[model samples]
Target: MSHFSIIIPSIRARLFDCRSSLFATFVLLSGLFAAGCSGSHDDEVGGTPPATVLQFRLQTLRPEIREIRESITGTGTIGAAQTSNIGVVTPGIVERVFVRVGDRVKKGQPLFQTRKNDYEISEQLARAELTAAEARAEQARLDYERAIDLLGKEFISQAQLDTAANSLKAAKAEAGVAEARLAQAAQRLADTTVRAPYDGVVTGRNADEGTYKSAQTFGADSSVLQLQEIKIVVAVVRVPEIYITRLSIGTPGDIFIGGMDGLFQAEIYAINDKVDMRSRTVEVRFGLANDDYRIKPGLFVQADIHPPERTAMLLEQDAILDRSGDPYVFLLEDGIAQARPVVLREYDPRKVEILSGLGEHESILVGPDLIRLTDGDLIPSIHDADR
Candidate 1:
């Protein structure tokens, strides 16, 4: 029985060893065949890899920058309008000047007076001529009456009577001329004093107590009082010719003087028809009331001309999402969002310009306060977020 047991055990061991070897040979051949099938044969298309999917957003945009025109600033001086230079109209030695520079004078106010010496002499001469002419005229009248009576009675020849009548008529005419001369001399003497032609401030005085002058005082070319009306001043402002379309007569504006901080409102009283060739600007007149006269003449001023009307793009304040102090937004494209930077041209409390960011028709992500977002991040945009 022991021998039979040993034989059975040897038989079992040999059969198990034979099965293990066959399994090992089968696994080795299978591995070799699989490697041979997968190996690269250097074919032209052998290196091709599988297609990949990259998640990204596609945003359409047409951005722009603000068009500015700061290059058009201009500088000019304010001045008084054109006026006549006042001068004395009658001739005499300057006796006394009533007004000096910095004095305000009204229309027809006395300014200066000429010496009465020349006027007195003229009056005396006229009076003497009048007396002589009157005496001669009286004598001629009596002589003519006697001649006429003699002729009527046929006691005098026609030629003698005619000559006597002619002499008398000439004497009367001379007397009339003397009377006119006397009146003119008197009027001249009275008008030797100069007066203001209109209400204005005295800008200059060229006369003294002893200065001799003629009726064409200081000649027609010379000036006596350089006066100007300053009740309302006209600021001569030079606006760039490029703004020609916006500028017109009667446009309202505000002027700021360099030395003062007060605002002076005015209207465009006048505008130049021609542009300055060298300065590339057009001179416009702005009329402002100088009631208190705080804004004096020759003050350098800067003025802002408001545009009557304008049209511009606007967006709601919340629509602009600021990132790192710069206003921006995450624009949606193909179910994803792309962060975009925008420039701010102008914005009030209500709206702002998307100067360089979102396009007209692009979809922008409104909210999700805690959403971590980046360029090409998947986003869900609902038209009505507040709903």
Candidate 2:
């Protein structure tokens, strides 16, 4: 027996109420499916099984312009963006140690001490000399007055009287010189003690108590206490030299350091004008406000530097179809894979930015099989549900 009807076919007939009455459901779903798949009765004229039929639809997925935060990570050691090596300009034996390693010190805070015996002795000797000079000057002034009185009566030679006045002036000048030397000696005594130049941590110590120090630099490692300022920290990032025009001094950026999960605001403090010949990358330095002193110098860091201004269409990477050196995508125009060529501006593994060859409000295929498709391929998709 043969049975044929518009309402039922063999594929629909075998499905009964016991089997979830899927035939009724299939019939209903088929109405929505067939209207988009094919519109002719001759589509079912052949004894083709539903499973045997191949329905390849070219779906156009128009993804939005995804805002991308691009970055170039680098590994660099921490350093005091502005290291102030606390040391002494004068030489002396260290008499006392005021601060220890890891101590937070303020600007001008005394760091260490030196022997003051020499300066004190010099000051005492200068005071005694000044006193002696003053007494001698007073005596000479009295003698000159008596000589002038006698010379008025022509009792002594004029040359003798001139000599007495000269001696008095000499004594007074000597006393003034002695007083200046005393003040200078006191300042030298103060300079023997080292002090912090800025607020920072004490990281190094080159001298110990009773150790001799000199005015001249001992070596490149002449610093006594190596202090690092963590309060406005620096983050370095190496970006491709090609992006030189995109980044310059004062550019805004973001910092993401390990253990510091949240995004921290930063600004481009320095952009190296010279490009590295070997790596062809430019170094950019960022300044961050690390109030808690968490962003220490020499800690590894990363940065995300956004472009000042760039415009492009972003789409999924799967949407790109590379065919014989010609990369293109099939866009849906009235529901079809209309293969159109696109200029790939940026082809990231996750997404792509189109410079041109696409229009707004046009649906484009983002399926994996975009490479295997061609122009004018039929798309039995009334807004492909899978897309």
Every model's TM-score: 0.54, 0.58
- Cα lDDT over the full model 1: 0.70
Which tens-of-lDDT digit does each residue in 247-304 have in candidate 2? Answer: 7677776677766668777777888778889998888888777677776776777777
Question: Pick by TM-score: which candidate is best?
Answer: 2
Candidate 2 clashes: the total is 4
Displacement of the residue 259 alpha carbon in candidate 2, Å: 3.4
lDDT of 2 at 137: 81
Q: Write the per-residue lDDT of candidate 1 for residues 1-387, one digit (tens) a residue.
A: 788987999999999999999999999999998877667444335876744434332222232234332222334555655445666667656778888888878899988877777777998899899999999999999998999999999999999888998999999999999999999889877777777777777766665577767655454256555777776777888987867877777777778777888777777888889999998899988877765656567889777776565444455555566533876777667766677777765455766766455566666565443245667666443453322
Q: Model 2: how large is the Cα RMSD against the reference?
A: 19.7
Query: Could you tell me the TM-score of candidate 1?
Result: 0.54
lDDT of each: 0.70, 0.73
